[model samples]
Target: MIIGTVDCFPTKSTLSKLSINNSQNATGHWNSKIQFGHRTVNKQGSPLDFKLEQAIVSGERDDFVLITANFTVPPRSTLPVDYELIPGVGYYKLHKEPQDWHTARVICNKEGAHLAIINSHFELSVIKMLYNRDPKLHDFSYVGISDLQKHKTFVTIFDEPLNATGYTNWAPDQPNYDGNCVVVKRDGQLFDTQCNGRFPFFCEQTLGK
Candidate 1:
């Protein structure tokens, strides 16, 4: 299971080398293939054997192509993505910088996850711990709570009622404005922020096991 980000450009080139985490144990050798339509386009003549964590990819892109591998694990093993794992909950990932709520959610979806879901106080605490880990990172990031319908009621991206989470930690007089998105502050309190505001985000994924 190799889970990681990738930097790409507009070129007819290939990834010379890259590393991804692997959760599988059978590591003798696996065949590699690069197919475009009906043609094999590997730069190398033969399908080479890859190391457990190393992968070789070849492609010709005239335009931009941004591809990131999602973490994969066996059905019997624990989750294997490279992110903070909440034991009873699931996996969570904190982005490096701030982005609008919509962009953050889109990116998280691309990474095979969604914005962090705060269903309990413990889950919120896990998000806070992840936020405080980096001194360079700000105190808050976008979570999955929002009032998309503008009905004066909040709900999670997963379709759960926010009040039902039973773990409201809003700041003083927070959500007093027209803002619909939720953010976790440095003081470990949640606040309602504008959806268009750019803030770092946390993504959550369930354990496949």
Candidate 2:
């Protein structure tokens, strides 16, 4: 039987007991702490979903024993469009309409996702390949990661460093001095642009069900 459930929410956190043992180490116990740096508990599988999972507790204690987790869900934006899986990371998709960076982010948030945060060359290449290339539309797409507040240091909506996953796909010595937001051209190259510049965009469902 299911001892606990995280339930449905934009973000979910759960605390569960998996075989508590109060007497396992009563005599030899010593206080300790564990730091798992950046960990993921349940990712719908999209690195772009970049919702960080944190463990509030993972060790045994005489008072109680449980596993605690946290999920940060974005607010409802729109019905989520279908997504293509990027393997163990998460899911990704591109929209048909062009919108400014801020607007595109809002759309993705409404749809239960966020503007795509490219985590690897493979995933970034996949997005470039799969994005629609209708001749009648613009040639750029908005991406989620940005250095809007401070140049040279980019971040996602959740405020995590852009390279938190140890991958970056900036195009050449791009992100010119004046721009803040990022846009991806058809050649899989990224360039920083004004937040109000209109463009189609990539979105990610992140890791989770």
Candidate 3:
């Protein structure tokens, strides 16, 4: 069943859901929050011919409609463009353009992602591999972890303790830097650095849970 505010669909038939096996020309907006193949009091999924019968209301752009259907979604279609899948990790995009920590965070958020957080050694290794491939990238790239709330007490951008992330591979004498933000060196080691220092960064997006 399609749910959410009526602003996005002026009439009951303004939006419809479709599910056809191997069907062509079936396109719709994708959101990670929607779960497919589920039957609940508030949510359900099935098939119907999708159509737009009326224009959306102005100044009602804040709301949205979620339509779930049982259809095989193409693997490549689930990811945003320019993102490279890192196997077990997630889809990531390396932003070569320099930006400070706050700006980097905002940009990634606007892109429907967050600064890449190294959750495991395997993920760090993959990041290092990507880093080594491009020699032009800055030596230090901004990551999602920082000690912004409490000096020397590191945490992920989500405010989770860094130690809880399963990986804390820091360089020798690291956390020694006076800065409050974190960065990942090309060698795959974490370091604390100035939040205002501009540098390249990685953004990650996990989709279709």
Candidate 4:
């Protein structure tokens, strides 16, 4: 895991460059402030093998003119296995194979984090990084917001009870509101979904105190 802060312009370039090789592994957003890169480097200070370099160079340069690159981490090993953890990000392990929305929330809360809340477009992109990695997990899974009273549905993680007024992006007839749980989909769309649906869960924890 490599975490860095780049200027808006070069960030787009890096993203575009990375996407070409690993479309499923790259993500970017308008106000990320920080970007996550999956590239790895070997112990000898050489770039390790990864498929993230081809996605950006397919002539999509114009879409990434406002991005920049800041910092990068070379891979490291601990006890014969190579693993890297970003400084300010949080990760959770699922105790069971799959958990429902409510169960996931409880687990995250118990773990000292909480069901991830998309506070901004930057955070939304982070959620997307987690959502797209697993197909067994539904495209959309429960987030941390709800509206059981008047709306009978969950609000978005951003806490917008009502759709962003003129910026509604729900699927047709969404917000059905059977159980009042918030869910985020692979495409970053939000919907009021039932809490009973089983899916892999994600949590957010503050870093560095």
Candidate 5:
């Protein structure tokens, strides 16, 4: 009785190192092949001795061979590429490209995420760290706060009041502008800005609330 389960958790760098081969079968069907030979490690940097022999994956119109080592990746370890999961918080992606608030929201929505809404000081710190990862990501980035519906009454994309997020650390004398959109500075403080102004933004996908 051999029951096996496979989980895949590859980082951006690891994915780039993978070799994918596409070839046609004898029945004139294309088969996808992925080879993984790199060392697998856990969070503690300990090497895991798990090797894959071969796996046949049933496809819609065809079948493919998935070859890998014997490894068990828990559900929590599996996450979408390009998103960094903050424990007890959520997954976040920082877009370097500048986009207006509305455009940013639309893009995030398309990706099954929303413009990032700060929930706590810890979350705010994580966002600040991500925002400062690249030197080109200077200045501020658009978040999910806006006063579009009512003047000076900021609400998140989820329609929750900004104050309810438990993180209302606004920049010194900020909200000074007669703007509807909000931006979080590198220092982890919020500021009101015009919705039409282009800026890099953060997208967040939350798990069970």
Candidate 6:
């Protein structure tokens, strides 16, 4: 039911019953000067006739309805993202395309303040949903954090320490000796990979204002 435009006109009997004569205004707009039935009946018996004391053409009526309907839609309070959020860790999404770790980081950075950070098993569960359609389920996705510094053991998008003691859920052999960047795999597991290796990445951000 995709109705584009509809012109609602009063039935001939309705117009005759209303006894509207010379009801057309100078602007060629219909006017409901004549009253009949329980309500005023103009050439066009639009709801606006009751509101505006006028008879409008079909197009004007449609525009009025559209504007009214738009005003009725509840304002969206939250930001736009296609995934649910974990209470603390961050929002989780499955990687879809091949992207280098750096590019992935940028994508997440654009998403919000916190950037993409995965730390708990529950967060991983949400990431796994992205890989359900793919047969070759990978281990983790590329998060915003990386350990590019020679002295740093771990790095976060915020340039903070990985803080291995808290909110860290690295998989076995993760942050491998040669691997300098972190990415979350489709399986919700964190793994270290060459920073240049392209893979899908997820973005993270804080919820609400």
Give, for candidate 5, the lowest lDDT window spanning 10 residues: 40-49
lDDT for each candidate structure? 0.67, 0.65, 0.72, 0.52, 0.77, 0.54
**Per-model TM-score on C-alpha atoms:** 0.59, 0.56, 0.61, 0.47, 0.62, 0.50
Task: List pairs with backbone clashes in candidate 5.
Answer: 51-69, 51-70, 52-68, 52-69
lDDT of 2 by residue, 45-80 (tens): 223223344345545653444555443333222334
lDDT by residue for model 4 (1-209), tens: 23443433335324222321112224552333333444333453323232333233334455443444444333232211222233334332322245787788777776566676655666666666655556566566666676755466445444565444223455667767665776667787767766687866556653432
For model 3, where is the 10-residue window of minimal lDDT? 38-47
Model 2: how far residue 46 lies from native, Å:
15
Per-residue error at 167 for model 1, in Å?
A: 1.7
Provide the global lDDT of candidate 5 against the true structure: 0.77
> What TM-score does prediction 1 earn?
0.59
For model 6, how does the per-residue alpha-carbon lDDT over 1-209 read when each residue is reduced to its tens digit? 22133334557553222333335556677543333332322232212212223333467346332211111111122334564445434445555677888777666555543346655556556556556767675444577677787633777766777774245766786656578888765545566778898776666554433
Best by lDDT: 5
Against the true structure, candidate 1 has what lDDT?
Answer: 0.67
TM-score of predicted structure 2: 0.56
Per-residue alpha-carbon lDDT of model 1 for 1-209, expressed as tens digits?
23333433323443233323323335644333332221122321222222234344656855433444433221222223456555456777889788999999998888878888777767767877777788778777898889887556888887688788777878888777668899888666888888999999988786662
Better of 2 and 5 by lDDT: 5
Candidates 3 and 6 compared by TM-score, better number: 3
Candidate structures ordered by lDDT, highest first: 5, 3, 1, 2, 6, 4
> Which has the better lDDT: candidate 4, or candidate 5?
5
- The residue ranges of model 1 lying beyond 4 angstroms of the native Cα positions read 1-80
TM-score, prediction 3: 0.61
